[model samples]
Target: MENESPDLQLQGLHYLTGAPVRIAIRQGRIAGVEPLNDPPASLRQLPWIGPGFVDLQINGYAGMDFNTLPIAPHTTSRLSRALWSEGVTSFFPTVITNSEDAILEAVSAIARECEEDEAAGSAVAGIHLEGPFISPEDGARGAHSRAYVRAPDWPLFQRWQEAARGRIKIVTVSPEWPEAEAFIRRCADSGVLVSIGHTAAAPDQIARAVAAGAAMSTHFGNGAHPVLPRHPNYLWEQLAADELWTCLIADGFHLPDSVLKVAMKVKGDKALLVSDAVMFSGMPAGTYESHIGGKVVLTPQGRLQMADQPQLLAGSVKMLPAGVSHLVKRGLCSLGEAWEMASVRPAKRVGLPFSAGLEAGAPADVLLIEWGDAGGDGSEPRIAGVYKNGVSVWP
Candidate 1:
């Protein structure tokens, strides 16, 4: 699969050259990349060339939720194909706050699908267990079920690790939770990525977690109360902590332009964009009942709000590409920088080796886009095409 003839050639697109370049693919890997003026006659002319986006945290898409109980056998594959259409070549199936049995069951089902097929774009690189070891406070916990939220338990984590068949990639927990630091260490020792989130952890706790191998702050600012005093809090503490990588849901509703700019300034290249999108995403704008929380509504403005509280963010209505677009639209970063936040940064977060933008000898996972005015409204970017392993997987 890795050693075969160059089957596809894409020409007239910029490579980080931001100037036109031609790319050739062989088998399932990149064969060559050259200036656009002198390309093979067969290469297809296109407008954009970039690395395919990789989402590190995505719950569900296209009306199919991964956390649905009595796990559906084909749900992962179905969602994977749907995400590929949206330019997500890879992602972690994030399962938030549920009973222990439900978590294990979900992990088992995902592991089965990953074991069955590697090409299934929704391959479970790892399970993002976002809760069960989180803040129990109402506003701090977001929409997670408080009954299931508890202190971190090593035995429980070990059981889940076994159930995932070693596919549990990242675990999100509150640093303030008792035993969280130890759990972070255990997760690090087992080669899993630990992320701090849904917490009121002080700067010292955050530092301790970082030293213990908790490397990320999940959706940094979205889960807190609407109003925060002008002093140190999880938000400001994380921003000041240089060792932490922050993941932001760049959906306009999750954060304001001002806060987004500050976060980008603090994290720089370490900032990653995630959808944190829920089951309601990819569905029509309307009221919907969530499995974890009560009824929620997707507003016409693309905000997902709690039916009881209009000001709160239920979850994100954005996807990975849109998240990147939000960063660029807000003038927080350039398109190339935003693209890296969605692609290379996430690929590195998940420990994938092929983080290079578009280069020869890299994986043939690429995205084609048609650029528009930089100041244009932040609508979802048009995906001209997506290639996975040198094969055209989306149009």
Candidate 2:
């Protein structure tokens, strides 16, 4: 007789309650979760069980570059499998601003990978198109190539969507253009999420975009002009808008702790975390050539910045797990709250099945995490095990 069964039981400390739990998994879904009858001698000895992270904006990871041209045949699949160790069971492969043909080719490659590879299909929930319809201003455009930046064009977007086989689910746009409201409405009507980002728009334009179905902000405080009017700026407008979900890069360097605290307080449950990671995410600290900025420096502190201009950030190198740990370390929020910002909240924002987490009938995209010590100075949470669709993917 076989000694193993398809059904599995995972025992750990519940992420939210910190109590011992036994989670039953069967047929790729969480069958049930109940308190453990026999607790471990020390609850602290058990790993923390929580939902696997859902990063809505991941440009690349572990030396994989989705934005780079001629994406290798195995890049998407490899990236998908690589993220398991980072505790990310699901993520949106972000394709940022590039030439028309380049953008089309990138997304098409991703779509083909999803269609052909089971791992890619299961891990990639959708594609996040971050540009080509964004601002052309120097600061507002961030590191995006200004030559390719232009006003929103529905026809161009439709072509990309068709090339993606309808896999482009989220788009980041700036409402500074006159045609933004109509574009936002069309995207929303088609059941696509339109995120406001990389903008130099007036406050009223931001408000109009919200009414036109722009549901979220992309890296809210990062991609903008360094200086703005005291009160009527887009930042203030976005902060006050109750309908917009805010995405923050809590990697400790992107935004200050005070800004993160205020945004979290204002957005509450609507606030979520995104890595906005680049290809150099997992690479060792050193100066490297990048397609976005000519040369970028990855500091030992995990900050990625423009080589010549250290004040300007190149991109985030920290993964979602690191962001969660930063939030907890800074006393901005509890560990559970930080984990949810990276996992549950982002999943909920995207309407993923596992948003309810380790409940009955939820997809078993779970993580067993090891917190080395319980203190403000504790080491980052480590991914001891990662389960995707009820099957262990990482160990």
Measured by TM-score, the strongest candidate is 2
TM-score of every candidate relative to the true structure: 0.93, 0.97
Give candidate 2's TM-score.
0.97
Candidate 1, which segments miss by more than 4 Å at Cα?
1-6, 38-45, 373-380
Please list the residue runs of candidate 2 whose C-alpha ends up more than 4 Å from where it truly belongs after superposition.
1-5, 372-377
Q: Report residue 385 deviation for candidate 2 (angstroms).
A: 0.3
CA RMSD of all predictions = 2.9, 2.0
lDDT by residue (195-239, candidate 1, tens digit) is 888887777888888889988889988777666767867778888
lDDT of 2 by residue, 1-395 (tens): 12223799999988887878999998889999999999877777888998999999989987899998899779999999999989999999999999999999999999999999998999999999999899999888998999999899999999999999999999999999999999999999998999999999998999999999999999999888888888889999999999999999999888999999999999999999999999999899999999777999999999999999998889999998888888888889887888889888888887888798888999989999988443445676888999998888887
CA-lDDT, candidates in order = 0.80, 0.91
